[model samples]
Target: MADVKVAVKILSELKSFVMQVASQEVVLDCFRRSNRDFTRNRKLPFDRLVLLIAKLCKKTLSIELEQFFKELGLENGCSVSAFTQQRIKLKASFFHWWNQVLWQSYYHYSGESTKRWKGLRVIAVDGSNISLLNTPALTKHFGGQSNSHGNFTQAKTFYYYDVLNELVLYPRIEPYRYGEVQMAYEGISQLSADMLVIYDRYFCSYKMFALHLWAEQPIPFIIRGNENQRMVKEFITSGKRSEIVQLAPTCPAIASLKKSGFIITPKTLLEVRLIRVELEKTVEVLVTNLTEANGYSDDQFKELYFLRWGVETNISVQKNIMQLESFSGLTVESVEQDFYATVFMANLHSVLIKDAQSTVNQLSKHKKYPMKVNRNKSFGKLKTSLVSLFIEHQPEQILLILHGHFIRDTLPVRKNRTFARIRKNKPGRSKHRTYSNYKPAC
Candidate 1:
């Protein structure tokens, strides 16, 4: 079990980092829309506003405003309109950089026990659609799909999730017109050789594979390939569990690469290994560069490929449990702020529970099903405690109280539980719609 003192130290470091960032006038200026924003002392200052957004505002704006100040032990709070005015002054990228510093601190202070698979950090790359308020400004900024009825406003999100650590390394919200593959390709600059990234079949492309291999430090990746593809079809028919093949870029792949300053001709072959994994209902082909025959065996590919599902589960949590689509403001800047702030808070919640999870594991080792902290409930507990955790002079007491709550309510992890996916036909209106007036009933 990790020492409770370690978690305490990490929490201290994170709070200090926040204080440091908020204190620097030069740093605050970079996140402001104009030089004059947040220059004067108003009801809401720069640091207070940053913490307010990180609180995961899912309630009515007015009520949330009142409660946020109340939590801080202050009787007075600003109005919703004032909050709206102040939030826009701050750029959304502030939360992005804030989350970057947060996870970096976690990895740094959490020590060497950070989870990895075969000495490599198993990072999963995936994308999901986020429902946004149907307004002219939002719709114009982020285009969405149309139907017989009308168009729905939405945005596409690409994420780099560290599945093992349950941290979102990068959370990006792009215009709905952008393809997931395009976003993934653009995100290649963030990848490192130490991480083994997993992708779904939608990300399978000749150019995508070449980009990883051509990086300054080649990144390792596993991409699920469509069975109908020529190479995959031939390999499937060969009946070999695994085989190394030379993949030649298609004309379109060549064109895309050439435009990106990576000149690849038709004869430019990318040597990749293809593995066949048998699922309960069917066999899936996985394209990868982990071709060492002994290092990663053909039999291990199935479980490694299955690890990609972690990202899918994480996305579901963001949508369902985290209420990620729940925006506090209507503008694009607010949307980005809410998105990145949620990522930061979620990562913090995950890290804070590590010690408690260890305690739960030790206590429930004899139980039939493996027990873990209930994340949905834990998030609520964390939300209420977040202010005190940062502001209290003695945060160790707050940490101890949080640790107790985390382990007190536990959920069982039932392995190999599968359910049929119910695919419903699209209705006249999107089943997933974000209302301008409704607040989440948490």
Candidate 2:
């Protein structure tokens, strides 16, 4: 188990990094210029406003503006309209840079071995849709899904998740009409040779595969095969466990590569290995660049593919546990701010629980089943204590409180648990109005 003192030190480092960014001269100057009351004193400073937004993002329940400002110690709190104006003045880039800073600091402090898989960082790529409030601004910016009942606004979110570390390396939001494949291609630009990307069948295409291979470092990837594809069909018919096949680029793929400064001709064929695995009801095909000669065997591919499920669970945590679909504001800027802030808090929560989690695992070794920290409980405790960790003079007291609560409540891990998938249709709202004529029975 990791030492509590070490964990405290890491938290202190994170606090220092946040303070450095918030207190930068350039950042302060930018805020001063943005504020209408630059010459007059105000209750809400730039750093305070940023911290307040961060706390709101982590809060489990919706907080009214009056109560929120009262908790911040503003006796005569600013009005809702004034607060909205202040929030609009702040740029979303501030949160973006802060998240980047936090990510880089985490990588520096946390050892590389903690996040690496066989000397490579394993990353998974997937996209999900976040439901937004039915507002005209939201509909105009993010679009919406249509049904027979009505139209509901939604925003498409693409994530590049670190499967081993349980962290979102990058997240992008676009309109609902945006294609996942296009967003995925944009995500590929962030890859490096030291990383191994895993993808679902939806991302399996000639252009996608070629783009990765053509990178300067040539990122290694494993993508589930689409059975209808010609190469995949041929490999499956051959009944070979593994074989190398040549993929001919399409005209559009060739043009894309040429535009990206890669010299390729019509005769150029890219070599990729195809691995065939038989499951209970179907034969699964995987296309990857890793080879047997390089020490990657057929058995290892199954385990590697299973790791991709971590990203799916990560999305579940965001949507269900964090309540990511609940927006604090209706504007596009506010939506973007909330999105990045949620990601930052998620990463922060992971960092804070590392030591407690290790301790719990060690203590559970003699029990009937292995136990893990209850995430919902830990998140709640963290939310209650988040502001104190930053603003209080003695922050170690708050950290100790968080550590104690996190180690107390733990859930047992039940391995090999399976259940039939649930399929349910979306529920529609009732058309009848209840507010005008309804009365309480009492």
Candidate 3:
């Protein structure tokens, strides 16, 4: 089918890039901690190590290794100790670079099919906490929080997620103490004019607005503002649906901007549009540089702002479905490796299932509710075929096989799903269980 060809072409592009990365000694050397690393051949070579990490290792190390080798049709495999040592020699930045470049490849190959909103990519910016192992090395590198019960090791992460495309274009992991706004500000340079970014109330800041508006290309953005914000509160008091207002930088924002090499005074003003959207019971204000009333009207603001939820859902998928915190190794390097690799795997899974999703949409048009590919089940199928899709010669056949599996397993698309949030007084670490002897063979 035509869908299978598109899947094959994308997989082949990724395979070629992976091969190019593996074969180039100059590129491989950059990923190595030392020039001596991966210089000689070993059971777990540089190329195999890269692919193995993308496998989403979630079981006992010994069992995962055995299955990985068996999938490659190899009888002999390296020990868990060997994998630990090999991974440490390679930097985690490799996976980060691989993820970014692979996303670029998807966009390049997807062409006109790449989703967009009003001639711009709908990007959502959000931050989340990732629980890290309680090892001294991890705790020392990435700080955690201490409460009445005990100390919990974790990391703060900021993600630039393309909501419409269902891809994480950029991901940043920092120490738990780092601020998300500052992390987001650091990502401003990577923004392009063709992106319209949406943010939640936590990211609402004068400095953030100034950076986006003052950028060379003037990146368009919409940020939800809380009722507590002075600017938002004033807008609500006016009882206007939408208004364009000037925002002056506060002393703290000016100081923060100065540290980032952007000199701004309190007098510096940013012209932003504020829109008020009424919820079922409460009202929320949105701040954005998109002041073109004709193009982006007040009514459209609600749905535009709601798009920010995509990043939150993506984070949930990463943590719950992908088992992101279920780290294979406790060292800082391994943690970083697993984190970025998980992002890559998530994107890969998203790209691979697009064809099946489209087919489901067409077939279910006459049904009561539209249907979608069951992502959890699709992920399992993709994981089993990941090695072959990358290493096997007949990727088209493998893709067709996956397409069949994907179309057969689907779930109905339920809309407007809501749940009440339960607030916990004391924060607790996410509990993930992995048995020592019991591991799934499939």
Candidate 4:
């Protein structure tokens, strides 16, 4: 009951903030046109509600189908069957825009602002592939390649999210055959010059680097050590241990990165920094331009490269744990739409959990209470609360539930484990054919 009340409250809060940003008519029209929902005379929009439901269902359906329901307490109705059978499609752009909207809402509700690092928000770029339902339309479009399932092409997505801002980002998807580097290169157009783009070796391109340099913000790129033989020169020399120096060349890769310099267009140059670090098999000469003379020392450049970890973890949560692959779409377009929506939901939840924790921490100091907010509980509590309230249609009762309810650090459990997840679910024998009504997005 407490959980149900809280779910409703959070749903109400999401709805209220959504309305304040977009008109009800405009929002509904976008959904109707986008074909994300199945609505007939449905006055109020439940796009966020359904997305939250879908996320919960996807996150749990592979785990404990029964307990997933018990957690949400929707055994009698809104079962996994209902969620699947409904087959509501949200606009891919709706999720993209919602990503923007939620960031704004977080700013409004949480009353915390993210300051730009070095007068700019440093964002990073990377890509990962997720499995998708291989319906005829999907197979024809996203064509699965190979894995344990044998040649089901994964949906390759290019992502750009910021680590410092605590902001999650929406990924743009492309066909796997196109390659992640190609996908990442195309995604560079969406990035602004003001943003610092930290990337891996693959993204260091002559043409694309020049484009950011041309952009107003003078894009700064932090790419990894080059494997290309042409990029290698002698930075250090020893048997099996030779430090290679990358002299600044006429490469367009860091054009935007050197905007602070007097020369607007950096002559393609190789910058080398001497450092010792161990890789798996062997530790060889590493070369980076980050030096004591430049703003960054040998250590800071390595630290910047390490920022790459944030994107890796984000992709893991979205793919392995969040079950983002088990989305409710048969077509690649629909899958893309759901993919972004899931991202928005995750980011929104991140903000909520952060805020809840901050609130508890503040109160804890005053009350001398040891209570702190647990991430799982904070996320679970908000999500579970939204499911019940929206389904029950009692938006007004939200505040009462949150009143005086402290976000607890400890999640509820029965000696199972800390931050327990249900074991991997094995599918029962069922017809492999997709629903006949399924149609591809045009």
Candidate 5:
């Protein structure tokens, strides 16, 4: 993780940033706020938490956690006492706080939720299957998927949608071939009132739907149209070949309606709006309890329902782009520890990216405090860019850093990015231009 750490120039700024973010007072208060003492047997100081995070950043990579704890005995030329071993395990509680804090921060930045057709907040639910274990021992802890080669290995998680913010919440994680849907069912009991939950076709079942109604939750639902399901068809195209049609409910449970009411089940009549769209040479059918007169167009409802893609993209970033599957750790505890840590890091970076951009945007608008252009020079795989920037003359500076090489660039409040155009006639032109600048978001 140290390889991913901030450089000295950026570190100073990052320290100030972290202080604001994970300040000691905030950390302690948050820990105490949880109203639980993690280490009741022995007490330990806060520096241990700092060391754990620093080590995660790979600042002191070679030493094992305990060895490092022992090494910390000599930190600042003073010996830390014997009781710090319990500190290591207890410190993880603080990370839980950090996670919650960051989630709240990201939540604010994400956006606010909006209601679907009849003012029910819409939520899209889905899952991502992850390979948590391949080793034999790990398989005992986190089971695997089944296959011809071996029983396939993975953890599938059901994620509840907070679409406006593009964040997934209430994840129900379990092994493949069993338990995911069950866990999701148990977790769904916590859903808020008046929410419209859209489900993948696979989750459609009479038993689950029955549980929802029994709870008296009063939350409407939308799911894909299963071909085998029976329903009363309302408004069919008079002679149109397409099998799709818009409808209001005429179910047995909705007898009072005789035909006009809002009901999710066949018993209670529901006024519904259905849409079938052709995509990729395939017909896709959707069922909704919302009607056309509800002030939300079918097009708008469908567009909002499509927000599930964001969660899939998030999983892609975590497992594919972030190289999580490359993890070589074997223990289940360590793997989960690493997973939570990575989640925290990803959340932190997301917050930082937005924060940095917001800061630059606000300051850049002011005339007296123009943001500077920041040039990011990567050391490159073999440190070639660093060599050119450090050893070569000014002519090679642009050549070395150009062509897809990017470090985490930070733009100052005021700066320029004009490169020379063939040895300019004037010295000012040859040098950097104070007015012209690079991309601020770089």
Candidate 6:
């Protein structure tokens, strides 16, 4: 099938990049013992360790070390201690670089322009909290939130999600005390002039707007405005659909900008456009740098603002489908490793499923209700076939197996579905159980 060939080509290209990274001396040095000779005793090479960790990330159930190695076809595999030691030495940057490589490769080969909106890649920004095991190191590094029930360790996760491509650009995990807006400010550095970033009202601040302008090549952004904010109130009172307003920097904003190497005075003001849209129940205000002269109209802004919901669904996929909260290790190092590994695995799945999705859409055309691939089933298949896809000499055969399994099951989409928001109380930490005993209904 055409889908099978596409999947094979994508995986082959990914494997080639992974091989190139593995051959780098800097990457190989990370796995070597400090005192060991670089030329000799290369027991667990960079590629093997990377494959091992990636396979672990894809599993639904926790796998022990010996069984994992045996599954990898290593009868005389290294000890569990050796793997752990090597994993510790493998810095988080390795996975970051790996993700960048895959993204660039996908961008080059996939001809993905259909996913873009009006010649712009729409990136959504948002933050969520990820629950972690209550260990001393985890609690110390990630911190926790306390309720009447008790305290549970949690980490703040920030995502720069590409809505059109179904890919995550930058995923950062920080201490629970770190504010979401602060993370958003730091994330601005990743943007380019061509990107159009969208944010929820929580990130609407003068400093955020200033940081975007301070970029080497400033990028465009759209952010929801808090209804109660003074600027929103003024804009609503003006009785205009859209307007460009000058915002004077606050003292704190000036200080923050100055510290970041921008010497701006408090009197300096930033000009941004404000657009108002009326919904069924209430009016929504959005702030953006997009202008009417650029062919960005008020009607277009309404639809573009709703695109932010894609990031919300993306987060749900990470938490509910990928089991991001169910960490495998108690240490902070292991937690970081699992976090980035899961992100990498998610992107890999996106790349593999890209071509198959079109085929799925075609198959659903005859049905009364349109359908899409059941992500749960596809992820399950990926978990079982991933190691073989990587290690087996004939990857085409494995890719075919994956394509056949993935396209078999599809779920109907219910259009215009709406549900009332439910606020559930947080259960106490006393109800927590070991991850091994817990099974998620995917």
Better of 1 and 6 by lDDT: 1
Worst 10 residues of 4 by lDDT: 433-442
RMSD of each: 2.8, 5.1, 3.0, 9.3, 14.9, 3.3
lDDT of candidate 6? Answer: 0.77
Error of 2 at 255 (Å): 3.1
Count of residue pairs whose backbone atoms collide, per candidate? 0, 0, 0, 32, 21, 0
Poorest 10 consecutive residues by lDDT, candidate 2:
433-442
TM-scores of all predicted structures = 0.95, 0.89, 0.94, 0.64, 0.54, 0.90
Residue 432, candidate 1: alpha-carbon lDDT: 53
Model 5 Cα lDDT, one tens digit per residue, 262-362:
23555432234455544455555566655455564556645655655656655655554344443424555445544554455444434323333434455
Over 4 Å off, model 2: 1-18, 25-40, 57-76, 259-263, 428-442
Residue 82 accuracy (lDDT) in model 1: 94
lDDT per residue (tens digit) for residues 89-119 in model 4: 4445656776766665554443335546655
Better of 4 and 5 by TM-score: 4
lDDT of 3 by residue, 176-211 (tens): 999998789889999999999998888888888888
lDDT of model 4 at residue 362? 58
lDDT of 6 by residue, 164-225 (tens): 88888888888999989878877788788878999999888888887887689878999999
In order, the Cα lDDT scores of the candidates are: 0.85, 0.76, 0.86, 0.54, 0.45, 0.77
Q: Candidate 2 — what's its lDDT? A: 0.76
Q: Write the per-residue lDDT of candidate 1 for residues 250-336, one digit (tens) a residue.
A: 999999998889877788999999999888888889999997664988888888888888888888777777789878888988999
Better of 5 and 6 by TM-score: 6
Leading candidate by lDDT: 3
Off by over 4 Å in 6: 1-10, 30-44, 57-67, 76-79, 112-114, 423-442
- Ten-residue region with minimum lDDT total, candidate 5: 1-10
